[model samples]
Target: MNQNGSEQKHYIDQYLREDRMPHIWCPGCGLGSILHCFLSSLIKSGIDMDKVVVVSGIGCTGRAAGYVKLDSFHTTHGRAIPFATGLKIANPELQVVVFSGDGDLIAIGGNHLIHAARRNIDMTVICVNNFNYGMTGGQLGPTTPLGARTQTSPIGNYERPFSLPYLAAASGAVYVARWTSMHVRRLEQTITEALLKRGFRFIEVIAPCPTTYGRRNRQPTGLDQMRYYRENSIIRHGADPKDVDIDLNGKIIVGKFIDIERPTYSDLLDEVMQRAFGTELPKDDTSKEEATVVGSAPK
Candidate 1:
C-alpha cells in the first residue's frame, strides 16, 4: 500500500518477505542484485513455491534465506550444504537451493561442498564469490585472488584462489556455470535451468563487495565492479571448466561449462534399498510399525 491509500505491488514482492523490507546489504554491494536475480529466476522457473526451500550459511549472502518468502534455514557458518543435504534426504520432493558466499561455502565448508557434489546430491548451490569474507570485516578468504588486498593482506595476498567452476566440475557437479551480477538476464536464465535439473548443480556468481573488497581493489563502488565485468567478461559456452580461472583484472570466462547427466544420491539410495529389500522404502512411512527395518541381506 502506498501513502495515498492506494494499492501498490512489485513483481518481486511475492517472492520476498515484505516484513523484512530494506535489506542490510551496503550501498554499492552486489548482494542485492544477486538476490534479485535469484528471486526472478524462481519466478521464471514456474515451480511450486511450497516445494522450494532456501538454505544459507553465515555470511553477508546468507541473509538471503531470511529475506526470501519460501521455507528457509540460516544454518551455522559453513554448514549450509550438510543441512540442506539432510533436508533433501528427509523429503525428496523438496527443491533445496543453497545461497551462500564463497568464504562460507569454500573456506570453512569446503570439504562438505566437494563431498556433496561427489555424492551427486539433488540440490542447487548458488555461490556468491565476493573475493573476500565480506561479512567479517573483509578478511582473506579461500577465493580471494592472488595479489588482491584485503584486511588480512594489506600489502597483497600471496595465496592462489580456487577456480570455483573448475572445482565444482571436478568434484562431479552435473551442472556448472559462472556469471557475474552484471549478467542479470543470463544469470536468471541459468538459475531457472539449474532449478529444474536433478543432480548437484553449482553456479558461481562474481559479485561486488564494495564496502570491503572493492574499497581495497580500486573498484570502490559496485558500479565500478559492474563496469569491470562488462569490459572484461567473455562468454564462451561449452568451454572447459579448467580453463576458466579468474585473476585480478584479467579476462573472466563466463558461461555454462558442464551440463551432464549423473545418478543422484537419492537415485542410488533407492537402487540399494530395492536390491536389499526387493522393494523401495516408502517415502512417507512416519509410523514406527509401518517403517521397514533392515535385518540381514536376503541370501
Candidate 2:
C-alpha cells in the first residue's frame, strides 16, 4: 500500500495472465527474474502492447509465452523462430519476439536462428541460457559449458559450446547483447533498446537452473549462482564476440557487443517488388516515400 493506505496492484499484474499464475519454474531458477525484466522492459519501451506478439518453443523458458497476457504462440520444439517469421511477414505491423531456452533455440532451432539473422528479419529474440536442458532433466545442451557435468555428461562435457553473440553477429544480426539474470536493471534496459531497434536483435540471458543444473554443477541454489555472476561478471561493451567464451566457474564478459544497420527483409522485398512491377505496396506514414521506377520487368 502507498502512504495513503489504499489498495494497490503491481504494474506487472496488468501484463500477466493471472489465470496461469504460480509459474512452473523451479525454486532458485532464473526464469522468474528474466521474465520480470522482460515485462518491465516492455513497459519502458513505450511500445503499443496490443501490437506485440510473443512466440516460444518447447523448454522451461518456453513457458514464458503461455504466462504473458499478450498475443502469444507456444510453438513446437525449435520452431518458434519460423512461426515468428511467418507472423512478421503476414502482418508487418506486429512486433514479434521469440522467447525460449538455449536447448530449444540453439539446438533444435539452430538452423532457423542463423537463417533468420542472415535474412535480417525484423524481430527480437530473448534466449535464456541456463547452460543445460532444464526442462529435460538437466541434460547436456548446445550451450552447456565444456566440462560441465549434467545428466548426459556424468563425467564432463567434452564438446565446446557456441559463443552466441559471435554466432548472431556472423549470421547478420543488427544488434546483439548479453546479460545475466543477476543484472536485472541492465538486462531490462538492453531489452528495451532491442525492442526499439529494427532487424534481427538477439539478447542472451545467463540464468541459473538450481534445481537440475546447479545441484550437479556445484551451484546448489539460485542465490549461489547469482553470487557467482556478481563476482565474476565483467562488463566490456564493444568487445569482440569471438573473444567472449564462457567457461564453468570462470569470468563472464557481458555487454552490448554489436549494433549496426541494414535493410530489413521486408525492405528488400519491397525493393524487389518495385523493380518487378511499376507499382509498390503502401508503406507506413513514418516510412512513406515517393516511388520511383528506373526500370520494370514483366510481372
Candidate 3:
C-alpha cells in the first residue's frame, strides 16, 4: 500500500474499488455519502469480503456495482434481483446484495422485487430513493410524491407514490428500515444491522439528487434537502409501516420498521428436497426431479 494519509484512507475498505475513484455522481448528490456508509457498515459487520456479491440494475444507483471491490454485477435494467437470486440459490454461502434505485427496483422490476421479498430470500437490498428518476432527467417515478412536478409530471403530479417501507414490510422482508442521507451514523448502523440479519433485508435511503430531483422539487441545493431531512425526520423505530407514506412536503417517518425471524426461501426448499430425496438435494443439479423420478435412481 502507498504511504497515504490516514484521513485519505477513510471509507477505502478492501471492499471498495479505489481505482474507480471520483465516481460519476453529481456535485452535492448523496450517492457518495451512501456508498461510504455502506462500506463502513460492511467493515463494522466484519464479514469476509471474498464472500460478498453486489448486484445492481441500470440507473444512477446501478453504477454502484461497478465501483464496489467485490463480486459485483451490472445486470440489465430491472433484473438485478433475479440475478442475485440465482447466485444465492446456487451457493447458499454467498452473501448477495441488490443495490439499485426506486425506478430500477420498484418500477419495471416491481414484480421481481415483491416476489423476491415474498419468498423470503436471504439478501440485503439497499434502495436509493431520490423521489424521481434522477438518472433519466428527473422523470416522474413510482415514488415521486403526489403534486410534485417532474419532467413527466410538469402539470403537478397527481399519482400517489409508493410507501416503500410499507411495501417492503407487506412483501415479507424480515428486516426493513428507512433513513435519509443526512442520518449518517444511524444509516450506517442500520446497514450493519441489516448485514448481520438473515432473510430479505431492505433499507430505503432517502437521498438528494440536487442536480435533478432536488433542483426540480424546490430543494435547489443539497444543503436545502438536508435541512428538510433534519427538520422532518422522525425516528420512530417501532412504527407501523402502513402509516409511513410520504406526502408533498410532509412529515418523513424514518426507522427500523420490521425485524422478525422466518424461514427463508432456501431453507424451505432444502426442507422439501430433504423430505423427497431422503437427503439434501445438491444445488448444482439442474434436473433435480428427473433423478428422483419413479424407477430412477437418485443422481
Q: If the candidates were sorted by their TM-score against the true structure, best first, what order would they fall in?
A: 1, 2, 3
Candidate closest to the true structure, highest TM-score: 1
**Candidate 3 — which residues are off by over 4 angstroms?**
1-13, 280-299
Q: Estimate each model's TM-score.
A: 0.93, 0.91, 0.91
* lDDT tens digits by residue: candidate 2, 1-299: 43335566667878888767678898898999999999999988999999999999999999999999999999999999999999998689999999999999999999999999999999999999999998879999989899999999999999999999999999999999999999999999999999999999999999999988899999899999999999999999999999999998999999999999999999998787677754545454324333222223333
Per-candidate Cα lDDT values, in order, are 0.92, 0.92, 0.90
Worst 10 residues of 1 by lDDT: 286-295
Q: How would you encode candidate 3's per-residue C-alpha lDDT over 172-255 as one tens digit per residue?
A: 999999999999999999999999999999999999888877777788999899999999999999899999999978999999
Which candidate do you rate higher for lDDT, 1 or 3? 1
Off by over 4 Å in 1: 1-7, 280-299
RMSD of 3: 4.4
Candidate 3, residue 212: CA error in Å?
Answer: 1.2
